[model samples]
Target: MTYDLVVIGAGPAGMSAAIKAAKAGAHVAIIDENPVSGGKLLGQLYHEPDSGWWVGRNIAREMIAKASSLGVAIFRKMEIWGIFPKWNIMLNNGERLTTEHVLIATGAAEKAIPVEGWTKPGVMAIGAAQTLTNFHRVKPGKKVVIIGVDPLSLSVAQELKMAGVEVAGIYPPPATEVSSDKSNPKQIIQGLSAMAHLAPNALLKAAGKAANHPTIKNIAAKCYPSFGVKVWGIPLHLRKTITAIEGEKQVEQVRITAIDGNGNQKNGRTKTMGVDCVCISGGLYPLSELAEAAGCDFVYIEELGGHVPLHSPELETTKDGIYVAGNITGIEGAKVAMAQGELAGTAISSRLGLLQKGSDAISEAQVKVQDARANAVITFQQHIESGREKLAQCWHTNVQTSSGKG
Candidate 1:
């Protein structure tokens, strides 16, 4: 049976859009690759106490229940491999879905820093580490070194500490200013302060002592100016780059050397650190491949990562009858994602005649969604600009090797 709307993700955005459309009397289907329905939100580490953004979880869960009540079909463990021009989706599990309307909300992927030995078994991204501790209840390692200084990295460190794992220290990559454009300075500062309060210096020092054991002497605390006051007492080191990773069965030691701003290694200035796990957090990238393939027009905005497709206030992409929402559009917290999802849902309902067009209710809802989207854009722009130089450097090297070949 052809569906009125087929959403290509079960995360907050897809779920929200599907529920709204289904409740409006449309035949709806939601598809996801994971065994369970919830996306990264469910698997994320719960380090900070109830931040407002986390409300998306409950909202998404409610939408799922509502959709089920409305007879909406939810398909789990079904991966969509391709999308045709006519909006026909090919699922890996031998199912083909055709829908009159399509919404892409596949979400974003975590980016990894290209450092020597980063591909080794002990090296993992911050997101991977969160999946281990939060979802599987498994600690990534007894002694761990985190390589970023954002709220996400800080949250990972706190969660690791709570799980009885020793965080050797947080090694921020470099000193970069927080972007004023993309951040709600007041709220971000408050969150950072609270994260700092959770793990005081005394606590980090104790963990350092435990990690400094002869067997684990490779662990050390190094600081970069970019990490700010939140990450104090970790041994401070600068202008260093990883040279090589050494170990037989598992990660045992890493060789690093000082380097100038020009990416040149300093002569005879090298150091080694012993550690079992290296968690890197470069940042996130927009997973807009499906959106792009669906004929959405993209513009390279420096503050929004790269190649963010232009979309209407309702999250509708340039392609008529197609929409984009959530992290697939840009990187923002879960709260902003939920707001976008709701807005898209309402717009779809109006377009399909399920809801009256341009009514007072729809107008009010649109305003709220637009405001949230505006704020999120500003915050995300700041983050992208803050790391623009490093990101550009990495992108240049990546392009030289990948050659625009996916």
Candidate 2:
């Protein structure tokens, strides 16, 4: 079927794009590999302190309903392997789809901290644990020891605790190339400053701000008690980390060791803690392989959470007629992704010459993306504005170079 737009990924961004474009007199179809729509929304559950609870599953259900009502086709459990010449989509199930416009919103992936026994049955990514508890309503473990101290792990640890699971505590990942400065207690404290705005209380917010300064933060980390501090009733161990997961078969225990504030492992100071499961979170990065396969150019911006395809602020990728929204461009919360989806949809519809009367919707949609970012409750990266400026510069440079070639 040749549709006006084919959105790849049923996550917030893709569904929202499908909804927007379909509303603009364009035939839109959305596809996802999961049997159910929602993507990461299937497991997200949290409170905004001011805005009340953010129930992703409920939001996704509402989006699906609205999109379906607008006559947007929805396909589930279909894996797309390639985007061929002339907008041809090759699905894993021997199906081909043709579309005039494509939006890549495949989202981000959890960067794993691969330590010993991490491949065990009970060890999983922090996101997997959230999915098990929130989405599937299943317990990941009785006593869970989480490795890595970040926003995602902290929230999931609280969730597990709320679900009656024993959260041993949040610990740092062992020092490794993959883990980077995340293994450093001091670095973690510094990085925590970026997440300060998301703290639920004023006291934590103050602490987060205080941690941003090098002198104050270093002194704090150096003086940090050997015993971890309890943040929201969950132990946050900045002075120690999980060095290795241990078990005869599955995950039964983990090796913990104290570290200096600078992140050097303290020798002769290792202990074992009994835990049924281990959740590692090395943070998140954009999953842009599909963007690459679609002939999009990419740039590695640390603030955007790794390699992201070069796209304009309008959400159009380097590849003509191909747009990218959400984490395929950068790792961010779902709200921003949805707004970008709207922007991309509006842009796509305008290109199809269907929005002649409502072309102003393009600018409005662009404002929405900015507003969403400014008001984002949880920001994964700091200096997002600067990161965006850098991305824009790259896009302009590429455009100029391409014009010169022509």
Candidate 3:
């Protein structure tokens, strides 16, 4: 089959981009490996403290409906293995599809920090547990201990509780004793600072506004210590770490240890908690293997989930005709992904000559995308704003050098 644009991964990003491009008169098709197209979105059921109930279900429904109404073809259960130049894509089902342009919204894969007994049954990623509970109607376990203190892990803990799973506690991953040269102290500070948002809105605002005053900032900082927020009547243990998961046929108990401020174990003090399941969440990283296969330039921006495709602000990768958006661009949330999808879609439509350059529609789309990004609820990772500036600068430099700017 041939199309003007073939989008891989029918998640928020792919669907948004497809809908935008289709509205601009491009024949678009979206393919995903799952039988359904929602991607991780199908599993996300969390509440935003400010926005009341924030459910991915509503967003996914809207995106799918819009795409369908726009006549954008949706193909599921198709795994793409090869992407040759000139937009030839090979599917695992022995079929091939060609397109004038491609957008990879492959999104991200959950990162698992390996601990002993991780391979045992009943041990899974937080995202997996969420899928089983939210989408499949299967409770992951009767009781659970979650290992991670990020928003995703915390939110999943509450979701699991609502789904009838008894959550023991949420803890941070075992801290590394050895520090690498690549480690950025500022990033650690930034992450810790952002943790204040987990508190009530008033506290978050106080911390942000008081940052300039060292005395006030110190007081504000003191207000937030690890695991400061309780969700669904569950405690998030910030000063604790999971040493191991113990089980025979399935998960039984987890060894928890207390750590000092430096992440070093404190006097070998250990505690054991009995649980039917253990959820490990090291974090999230972009699933950029396909983009790598496409020969896009990659740069290691730790802030944007390790090595991401180096692309222009327009969302075009170093390789022509291939664009990216969503978590694959960085470790952001569904809303950001939707905004990015809109942007990439508009850019692709303009590039395909379906939309005139400098047209009102294109300008409007760009403005809307910018608004969406600015107002996003979750913008994790560090240096995202400056990192984007760096991308633009590098892209401009490359273009000027190619054109003999010197």
The residue-by-residue lDDT of candidate 2 on 96-206, one tens digit each, is 999868999999998888988899999999999998999899999999989888778878888898899999888888888767699887778777766676785553575
Model 3 vs. true fold: TM: 0.88
Candidate 3's residue-wise lDDT over 1-406, tens digit each? Answer: 9999999999988888999999999999999999877898888876566677766767788888989999998888989999998889999989889997899999999877777788889899999999999988899999898876565776688789888899888776776542211122222223434445554345334544565466665444344465544556786564567888998787889998876544455777887888989998767899999999999988877767778888877788988899999888888778778778888899888888888663566567667766765665555654566666666677787778867945
Local accuracy of candidate 1 as per-residue lDDT tens digits, 1-406:
5788888888877787787778777788888888767676665544233343233345556767887899989998887878886788888877888976888888888766656666789988998888788667888987877765455676677777777877776553422233221122222222233233344455334433433353322222222232233443343222344556567777787776664432245688867778898788666777888888777767565556566656665667767778877777777666566666767777777777888653554566667655765443113334443433443444455446556666
Q: Give model 1's TM-score versus the native structure.
A: 0.74
Off by over 4 Å in 2: 201-203, 357-359
- Which portions of model 1 miss their true places by more than 4 Å? 45-63, 173-243, 256-267, 357-362, 370-406
TM per candidate comes to 0.74, 0.97, 0.88
Q: Candidate 1: worst 10 consecutive residues by lDDT?
A: 179-188
Higher-lDDT candidate of 1 and 3: 3
Ranking by TM-score: 2, 3, 1
Kindly indicate the candidate among 2 and 3 with the higher lDDT: 2
Distance from true position, residue 360, model 1, in Å? 4.0
Error of 1 at 167 (Å): 1.5
* Clashing residue pairs in candidate 2 (N, C-alpha, C atoms within 3 angstroms): none
- Candidate maximizing TM-score: 2
